[model samples]
Target: MFEPIIPLVLFAIVATTTPGIATTLSTASGAQFGFRRSVPLLVGSAAGLATVTGAAAAGLAGLLLAVPSLQLAMKVIGSLYLVWLAIKIGRSGPPNLDVTMARPNSFLGGAGIQWMNPKGWAMGLGAAASFAALASGPMQLALLLGATFGLAAAASLSLWCVAGMLLARLLKTEWQWRALNIVLGLVLAASIVPMWRSA
Candidate 1:
């Protein structure tokens, strides 16, 4: 059981560090609004993911797996959303610090996007399943797994966001900023390949 925790921890770390809605949003927020303002969004998303994963471990994922149609629905919905997000990212321009800084949508928008993300649900469920298999007691194991994964996710995401902010400082010119957005967008778009193939 204890040995299994190592693999589980690695899985959580990889899942959290992977570029997706939460990571993208955090990076965007940090690049635009700075880390201080983005903290709430990070915390909220981490908390939400922990709850979702724990619920999945408690048999919610099993229920979903049992329903073929529901699983299909999730795949379709998630795929479409990922594509939409890629398009949105491609269209995004450099952060207008003045405008974005004044925007109130950062925190709630970041958290909401992550909460609805289908890939996130899948990952959470998968993590829950693995943890459940090795856990001696369900609730205690879930809590332990949730806390460990939650912390990893929150920290990794915050680091990504902070990195984005730091990178923003290097773009002293408009072209550099636009180029950065384009490159990041391209990277994110390319990431959808795995998700599509999995679907």
Candidate 2:
């Protein structure tokens, strides 16, 4: 019983820690707003991802897999959204430490990202498919996967936020800030490859 769960835990860790749109946004939010104010975004993202995981466990992932058209549609929409987000990040100016000057991402916005993020969908689908045999029933599997993913997401997002805050200190110059944003934006845009391939 526990043996099967070990692999699931490892998968969750890897999936959550890997760079994706959610982590990218969390990093950007932390750089601009610091860890304190970015809490809601992080929380919302985790909740949204957990919900996705639950849906996957409930067989939505299988449904998507059976319908290539739906999967392709999701990929296209998610990729376009990521590209848009990358553009927004690339255009953003230096962070104003004064919270009043620039607002951090809102909770709803963060949740929305996860809801549409291709990586999040992939993670949830992979996790459910990989670990479905471990549980005795569907509800049990859904709860198990959702809880594990939620915890992993919380930890990974917090780490990314902290890393972003630390990087913010080093990005004092305008050029440094611009360079960082450009790199992050490019990385976000690059995620489209896997999404396309999966389709």
Question: Which one is best on TM-score?
Answer: 2
How well is each residue in 93-163 modelled by candidate 1, as lDDT tens digits? 65544334354234455556666878666766555443444555556655766687678879988887887
Query: What are the root-mean-square deviations of the candidates from the true structure over C-alphas?
Result: 6.8, 7.2
Compose the digit string of candidate 2's lDDT tens values, residues 22-106: 8777887787778999999898888888888877776744555456356455545545666776687677655544333257777
lDDT values, one for every candidate: 0.63, 0.70
Who wins the lDDT comparison?
A: 2
Query: Cα miss at 162, model 1 (Å)?
Result: 0.6
Model 1 misses residue 26 by how many Å? 0.6
Residue 52 error, candidate 1, Å = 1.0
Worst 10 residues of 1 by lDDT: 96-105
